[model samples]
Target: MKKLCLGLPKGSLQEATIDMMKKAGYTVIVNSRSYYPTIDDDEISVRLIRPQDMSRYIEKGIIDAGLTGADWVKEAESDVRVVVSLIYAKQQLTKVKWVLAVPETSAIHTVNDLQGKKIATELVNVTRRYLAERGIVADIEFSHGATEAKAPDLVDAIVELTETGNSLRANKLRIVETIMESSTLLIANHNAWEDEWKRTKIENLAMLFEGAIIAREKVGLKMNVPNGALDQVLKKLPALRKPTISSLSEGAGYAIETVLDETIARKITPELKRAGAEGIIEYPLNKVIL
Candidate 1:
């Protein structure tokens, strides 16, 4: 069987990626000591790679496609095809940032203050380029792990990736500058992207992934409304598309259904009830591919 080798980020993004795949209609199984994961799709083989290294692997065509942070692509300077931007992180459905931080008590309060200081980060090349653009001369050191803790003593300042500022605050670090903001990207190898089969497969997966992400923030609502109060109920609804309304049997009013943001669904449920909506049902959605 012809198979497309796929790389899934192993560290922070692993669990989230696996869950996303499940929601997108794929089952991915990973063993404790295995780098290769078993995905239900026989046409696609899965391997676990670090997000930082994902771009390089894709650039080399080691894997047909993979999911990783956009920052890593720029950091690696890898030539690859970005299939789609998946805006999600390990903790939340939002972009993550690489920021320049210093100890809260440090004298450095701005990027210029790092003129000749040493900095620590896993993203060495990107950090170097960022400082170079500002004409700031600083020593950029490569940190294997625990980059947030290398400041104040081992390094004068540090460049770290954060979803929230909680970790930085806990480490007593203050952000002086935001270097870059990145979201997860579904990327493909240049060569693989030119192949019809692989391209179609990658695009299908990207579509499904996007649908699952959108579904996470939305829900489906269905209710019955008296014909006399139809206008009121309709006014209370906020929908991605027009609210779906159908007349009931004989003289019964209408059965209305629509998809809307989860937050809006909650707030408007009471208003809908007051508007004469009956048998109201709010349900979870697996996918919303509009």
Candidate 2:
């Protein structure tokens, strides 16, 4: 079988993507100046490309599959099958938004207010289409970089992508409206999806990616409880599914284990301890395949 060529997104999403792949059981390593990353899987080869170029590359069959933001795929108008949506960005695991923002002191309070105003953004095509949809015409310029800083002085308004509004606020800008919400997507090329072996391989990788994402927000909890107090302990525990229960050696007690949200660990740990649970252990998880 031929090795599958996979395009990994470079730049801001690079580190997070690599970390996710590692948790999914793939060893990915990249040197400072290398565009090609090394992966442990012999069946796969990795190339680092920009997220904005991923969809077009995959659509042209330059790579079998890739990870990129949904907004870029839409902007490129690339025809690729979306395997799954991974809701994560550079800093947070949440949906990112493309928004129309203006200087805080500007009088443009609404989308319609920018009729003849100048707008700058990296997403020129997407912004053009958005404006055309609303029957609004404006001078939309393609900003090379620093889109947020172009507003007020460089342009009357700006369309920028943001995971959180903190950056815009830091630049003394306020969002007029959110143009679209996007998430990271795993996409497959058309021809590659038609091949049985390739399809199966992509699906397996998608499963692992999703499993790793789920694992990041959760943790494993294990504890020993007196057999008589098992019911009480179980009642106080929260799990993704049902908790795993086992009989301890010599029938001394019951061992219980479960996967739960990491955020509530602090609140639940003390409660379990007070309810006759012993040797309670909370540990981080790399992946959890359902």
The Cα RMSD of model 1 versus the native structure comes to 0.8
Ten consecutive residues with minimal summed lDDT in candidate 2?
Answer: 145-154
Best-matching candidate per lDDT: 2
Model 1, residue 120: what's the lDDT?
A: 94
Cα lDDT tens digits, model 2, 80-138, are 99999997789998999999999999999998998998999999999999999999999
Residue pairs in clash, model 1:
none
lDDT of 2 at 65: 97
Residue by residue across 176-221, what tens digits does model 1's lDDT show? 9999999999999989999999999999999999999998889999
List the candidate 1 regions with Cα displacement exceeding 4 Å.
none
TM-score of each: 0.98, 0.98
Clashes of 2: 0
